[model samples]
Target: MSPSAVKRKLSSSARSVSPPPLRRRTDAVQAQRAAQTESTNHSHKLNFYSWNVNGIGPLLQKQISFTPDATYPLRNFLKAHEWPHFLCLQEVKINRADTATQRRVELAANAGAQSDEPTYSTHFSLPRDKYNATGFSGKVHGTATLTRDDTLETAASVPDFDLEGRVLIHEFATIPLVVINGYWVNGTSNPYRNPDTGETQGTRHDHKLRFHKHMLDLCKSIEERRKSVLLLGDMNVAPTRIDGHPNLRTSPIQHVINRADFNLKFLDKDSETGLKGIDVFRHLHGEKKKYTYHGRGRPWGESCDRVDLIVASRKLVDDEAVVMDTDICDNPHDRGHSDHVPLWVSLDASTWLNQSESKVD
Candidate 1:
């Protein structure tokens, strides 16, 4: 079957439960294979860069830059370390009703490569007025993913929980990995009232919790298919207190609930039914006090939290030296300032991808 046909069948058949994925192979065997491959092979590495642009339209229009030194900030960022194979974004703030701009973005991204499958594939999940509790007024939540790799087979959103443009999942044929890029809802209960009717219906903490649940469910479903998952984006909830700085929650009921849920669902490696996504930054940094988001009009160091994350499945990272480096980066140029900085990871794709398909000629 064609790749598209296979994607369609998978989506339609997602309702039926599949048998659990088989247990991983022994680590001794994995290490033997890793010893044969160079950990520093640039050709066998895939670099994934993720940032919640806060508003992507400005970046596209050149109205803003991640830094001051470059006219095209994206170009500067791409070459900052290595070429970013996949650029995953969050908080795109694009409304669902706007189709014109979406089409334009696709056109611009694939301008030169005009094939049925362009050199770049872009997918955006935007918020719709009918689907949002606050009625999708002003810039809200959204997510997008762009990839130039031809192995990208499908791009999709979470089934029932995708109305707010919070999640985007990409499946690639050449790799044994699924990428789940999400911009999770900030935990808030602010209500938006109708100007005249005084009828109020805004978001509550429940909405945020439900979004987390749906993303986890999607991860579980994908893992059942025997593909490792890389879940990355602005998850919003800090799993531990150390993640927050000057963290003035002082133990609010909301914090307690949110933290506990995150711990069990994503952080807990022992949970038989949880997503079990290993926190890549924490795993590498080891309680290092670094922050990704600066809030409340505070400078980065004074008040911030590492809300942005890059979590990978255990199966994908178990091999030694798969994760080359993971770090939280700040703006090198002083021109434009965004609250959230970029988080990136470079990994040896050959370590996890099937050896036969790992190398691309």
Candidate 2:
């Protein structure tokens, strides 16, 4: 073959095997990575429910010592609403010493079953007898949380605050979240009566100062670890004037203190020195009036305040897959039980479970 013909054939081979332009190669790689992320990511709707049951006894049994009824108010709740992934109960009024009572509460919570294995894992933060000094039993202020058995990586209560059975912290197995369930101290201004002296002592409002400061720290601790937080249960604070009916609080100063603390430190979106906790309700429905707690016998709308809340971390809210819906249940129940009605939030399963699920119970 001639030298010119050989050279031409070599040039053709080189042109055929040439690499793609840099931009094209980069875009191809980016498209492949995007596809992988899209495949792994998903949208989910997970329901979580919370209620201040007042007492666990009435739902399962007429009294703590009696047998649980065949049908219960708790049963009515579960059947009526989407079976929640986590059910947070506040003011359970149970003590650690009463293991039997705790077990009964657990049994009723897990579909009121006495024989079947429990589908939920129950965790309670029981109270100490510190208040016994004031002629009141500390056993009346417990907080509890129940989730599916496999959902937790770790679980605990606040060491100092839980003496009144006020808090439970849960780290989940499937999400980068640390959940806190609390029955926050009620800052009632009525001074405790000393039966011995027939006189009054300082108010329970003192506990409020400490309880809230620690609550802020707890959220910060989770934020420091780069994990999100979802805190729910009866916080006992109305948060703003619109959150309460006028004059519902007997202690305005105490109420003001608490409302300020919760608003400025956590729920304020413009906060520069906070965990930037998102009030799930306010985030979804801005300034729309809603109430969760009602006066015992009055009509709900006539006299009530919205004290129950589900607050989330900014990180969690920023995630596109996690849809937090504001269909909070504040109503006359299918079966009326507690003065404080049930409330809940919806989360997408794809945000954690990486799959889609049925929206219904």
Candidate 3:
């Protein structure tokens, strides 16, 4: 079936399941994507970036132990790549003391503090309940989007199934460029296992599965609108061995390799699209072991593996999106950034708009 047709089918099916609030949000998202995709042609372009900044607190702390200064290194890096039209950031944590409105301003100021010009506008999704709580500080975890242009549209932060952090979305100048910033829950190596039931008995695994489902659902919904989608974030789960640690072959992480509920736990196994709507870090590099996570110690003390990822819709690839891995920092100790490396992809926004126009003719 055609890609657009596939999207519609998914939407119709999702709607059949209650079709009220979920349907409304999905429908609005679909319309927004469609409208964004049709807005401009070649003259305008969008650049998307994603990274997991482990925790903003450590970087902003008075005395830090890590090597590379997080604030300075990241700021310099952004300054160097100053031309990206749109940037998506995962793990853009915000302090609860600040309101959402206040947080965005702080982020913008922070970005500008590191750049000569504040070329990016910020958008984020924080926890709803936390914002409503009495004397609530602000969201603990979430995602944010930054763009050179002030054209980000209809931005929303869809809380994922885990209810841990936020997944963010926005349009780049109404062009068929819809960017999603995500930070999936990081898996716990020593999750609380029921002594009687073992590791398979808890809500941890279920939470991971729910996170994947939420991501897939969003991807499918966006595909339904047939826009060029760029889903970027710290995915936490490696789709393949190349994106995992080297020791995985001999002694694999049981939870990762097991296909028991693989289809439900990872994006590589969505039955309907079956990973069609997903692409990952492995797509850019065929390397292994080089990881993004370091055991909670110092930045480079003990390494885990690559969990961060940049996924693009197959439709976007066909539209000539220049997707690649931008492994900006190697040593978290040196950069004072997150355990994960920042990954970026550039899409020729004009190309999609122009091609769509041609098809109309």
How far is each candidate from the true structure, as Cα RMSD in Å?
10.9, 18.0, 10.5
Which regions of candidate 1 deviate over 4 angstroms? 1-42, 62-71, 103-119, 129-138, 149-158, 191-203, 248-251, 319-321, 331-336, 352-354, 357-361
Consecutive 10-residue window with the lowest summed lDDT within model 1: 1-10
- List the pairs of residues colliding in candidate 1: none
TM-score of 1: 0.74
lDDT of each: 0.63, 0.64, 0.49
Instruction: Indicate whether candidate 1 or candidate 3 has the larger lDDT.
Output: 1
Tens-digit lDDT track of model 3 for 1-361: 2112211111222212111221132565446544443343223444566667655544333223364433433444556665465556666556433454434333433432422233334455544332221122544566655544323333444534434445766543334656677776544443433333344444444555655667767766766776556767776665555554444332335465332333333344345554465454455555534566565554353446665666667665544554533443456553444556665665545554455556655
lDDT of 2 by residue, 135-193 (tens): 23445877776664322234444555456677877765445777788888787776643
Stretches of candidate 2 exceeding 4 Å from the true structure: 1-44, 62-71, 111-118, 132-137, 150-160, 190-203, 246-251, 319-321, 353-361
The lDDT, on a scale of 0 to 1, for candidate 3 is: 0.49
Better model by TM-score: candidate 1 vs candidate 3: 1
